[model samples]
Target: MHLQFITAACLLASASAHSTFQQLWINGVDAGSSCARKPASNSPVTSISSPDLACNAGAAASAGVCQVKPGDDVTVEMHQQPGDRACRNEAIGGNHYGPVLVYMAAVSDAKSAVGSNADWFKVAHMGLVSNNPDYFGSRVLNDNCGHFTFKVPAGLAPGNYLIRAEVIALHVASGSGGAQFYPACFQVNVGGTGTVKPPTVKIPGVYKASDPGILINIYQDLTTYVLPGPTAYGQASPVPATTAWPTTATWNTALQPSTVPTVVPAAGATGIGKA
Candidate 1:
């Protein structure tokens, strides 16, 4: 029948051109059934030793939690396979780019949200947002379309917290295991009194598979780029570095489209995880 609908739309556009990291947001709601994601598709967890790196290891686990204060604005929604959310933007076809991270850990309640021992750090970061030298990494894939906003770092120190968002493709990293990490985790509950602890790295020892930004090579000789961890803690307010670049970004259009739904919070919970 007409080449089977063009072979099922080229296998759903090659599985939305390889995608991962499902959902996580604060100012926009939806914490993916209450953190500990792995809900489905949006793949990529190619053994950084696989504890699902701490969250996905739960693989769809949920006790639900998502609340915020102390400078909210989390947001991080990417998909392209597990029920497809129309994802795909590796700069059009130059393969996936790299750099884009966030981490935090401090849950000893709510059954310890993030498993695998849990002990993450680093707070907010964005490599090549304009680091000159022809800004590599496809400028966050034609200016970040997969959505990844940052915040929640205003001296944070409330209570339950487990936020982790990552995107390190490295375009095959040239070697040493061909870089491709797509982490995801979200379970917040900070109402805030502000103290700011900050300082705790332990995601496979803060990444070190030859750690030169996770083994370089973004197509060819990259001039300069170094954005591994630490030094990205809620700098005042700078969340909008490319709302959703298509023909060159600038499409805010009233924003709010990460498939918003889950805001669950209430099951022996402490409060603030929103309903």
Candidate 2:
């Protein structure tokens, strides 16, 4: 029985490492209604070309889409569940660290928008550090560090849009097709008077197997990590100020990640073992 228990423990730890996009909040409201993977999904979208890349394509339209003013602080939180009610950061193993990116595209209508053909515009991106050369060190995916806040441009036009959040893990990126892509999409309806149109790109076509960010190693000593994709439209000097920042905003700190204790799962032990 002892031997059997040990094996089970190792397997459970491995199981928890499955990268999944469990929850996403828009302007502080739970927006799972517009996402393809509901709160109950068991796994994340692993394929770059899966229909999910486009609003997870076929799930019926959701009522959770948000109606927001241009200056709103669109805070987004991505979490990974190791088990039911046991939530943690999106990144688990040291191998799963890279850049976190968000994009937006105006849709004809929020209620009828499915993002497959929508031309996406780069809006927000976070992957830079003055301390870490790799830009994305273990700090990105460790210790419940999966939350991000997107500031809606005050100059944005009023309309329906789809927002895409992505995190690329470069641990195995040394080889072709080795990088793992985890992306989640949100539908929103913005209400404002500003009118600054942003450039757009087609999905699946935008990301290549050989993209610089997608095929690199995070462990190597580096100085700078160039974020892939066209610079977000209208991302010029004096970016729009964040209006009414959330009291619970999770800023991507440039400081080194502080250490935190973790429960080490015993090798081959069952039931997650004793801490």
Candidate 3:
């Protein structure tokens, strides 16, 4: 009966382990925007300006619909409005022959209600599955924006890549347990080659929640990763064998006889005697 009860409990717990995540895209001018910004010239080849320009050049063309060249530097900017927010970043140009710079920003609550803590609004890169990296979260000043700049590795192969931003919303519970969180993702494109302008790709307005590849990746991580040892509270350990109590004879054999005697005495008698 005890074993049956345990089996039933385990089955019920397994049935209840179906928590899921739903990601929605924040809409505005920036929802489907590119990082590529308008350059001083539409020319393909140009001199390197500054490090920031190197990163901004590709990102601006990718997100902002600007034509970029190999050595041209571009600047990408994210503007926050009252109703919605925008994310702008860069990618490698299609014809870009030399190295390029990519600038990115991860912004949260650009228009919505973000919790009191500032760290929740930052963005970081999410690598491919089986290679998740530790993401560093930073704070963005209120009414101001957050920015990040990185040089596109020199001589990178031309291909499609996503410059993404993650937005988090905090929901406070009535009791003292903790706050809940909702996370959203946004992406843009980068294009152009050293001397050739790459064809443009249509950016998706919203994120697909039902992507099977993404689901499989997240599922594998939650199940396969194991800790070094059993949990401190023994929750993950196997149950130990139970032992029965000792018999009366066994208890008696383990004890020694006492030296004192049991006796009864008359109240008036000077000496007591056993009755």
Candidate 4:
């Protein structure tokens, strides 16, 4: 009976490692779950050409759009299941090492926007941060309790925008079509008067299965890891082959909310974590 119990525990742990982006934090405030259109499951989308690569597979539409301004620090949080925000577990476990990317697309209606139909532009990206320690973006996220933070481009035009955060797990990416893509979308209303529209790329068209970054072996000592998507807005492509990416995490884990944030109605305004 003891042996059987041990086996079951291991199985549960393995299943929990398959994660999804489940929460959002804006400027150090927990924006709650309503703003995020989280995937129904933690399973990954392997096909790069599928429309599911845009937001996720079967992610129901979200009614709430979190409010943000240009230059606000936005963080996306991931976990194996909804409302599972434990700090001890790795966000994407089982040696799933790869990059964390964030994209932004202006839309007519953030709450109802179809991710596949929007033109997405890269906003932030983090790949292998260090070779000596063999640290990856996934590791960074795990260190911070599944939170990956990036800033809204300074001059982004104010409007309804869809923020897509993704993690590309390259553990089994040695062969073609082996990379696993986990993407989640969030609705946000930008309130700045800034007007700058960067170049955009379609989701299904951005990543190719044959891309060097998507079809590499992370088990070996990789001198460089190329990011699959285009250059982030107002930032140059990071050359990991020669330059070392900073290992310091910008998001403060000490201030992390112990409980998941929730929205409360007060004075005709819905509070944090709600629309």
- Would you estimate the TM-scores of all the predictions? 0.29, 0.69, 0.22, 0.87
Q: Distance from true position, residue 199, model 1, in Å?
A: 7.7
Window of ten residues with lowest summed lDDT in model 1: 266-275
Each model's lDDT comes to: 0.58, 0.55, 0.21, 0.81
Query: Per-residue CA lDDT of candidate 1, range 1-275, in tens?
Result: 87576456444533445565665656655455445465354556656666676555445555666667777776665554543344343422334566667787877663355445677776666664543333433345334445566677787778887777777766666577667666767776787688887767666556667778777765454545677655555443223333222345432423434353555644343211210
What is candidate 2's lDDT per residue for 1-275, written digit by digit as tens? 87466446444543455444434444444333344333234344446666565554334455556666676666444555422223234344534666667788898976676666788887767554332333352234343345566677778888888777777766566677766666766667787788977778887667777778777755556556667677756564222122321223134333212331122212232221000
Q: How many pairs in model 4 have backbone atoms within 3 A of each other, for residues 3 or more apart or on separate chains, i.e. clashes?
A: 1
Q: Which candidate is the best by TM-score?
A: 4
Clashes of each: 3, 7, 31, 1
Any residue pairs clashing in model 2, and if so which? 5-268, 5-269, 6-268, 6-269, 7-268, 9-269, 52-56
RMSD of 2: 12.1
Alpha-carbon deviation at 132 in model 1, angstroms: 40
How far is 219's C-alpha from truth in model 3 (Å)?
27
Model 4 misses residue 146 by how many Å?
0.9
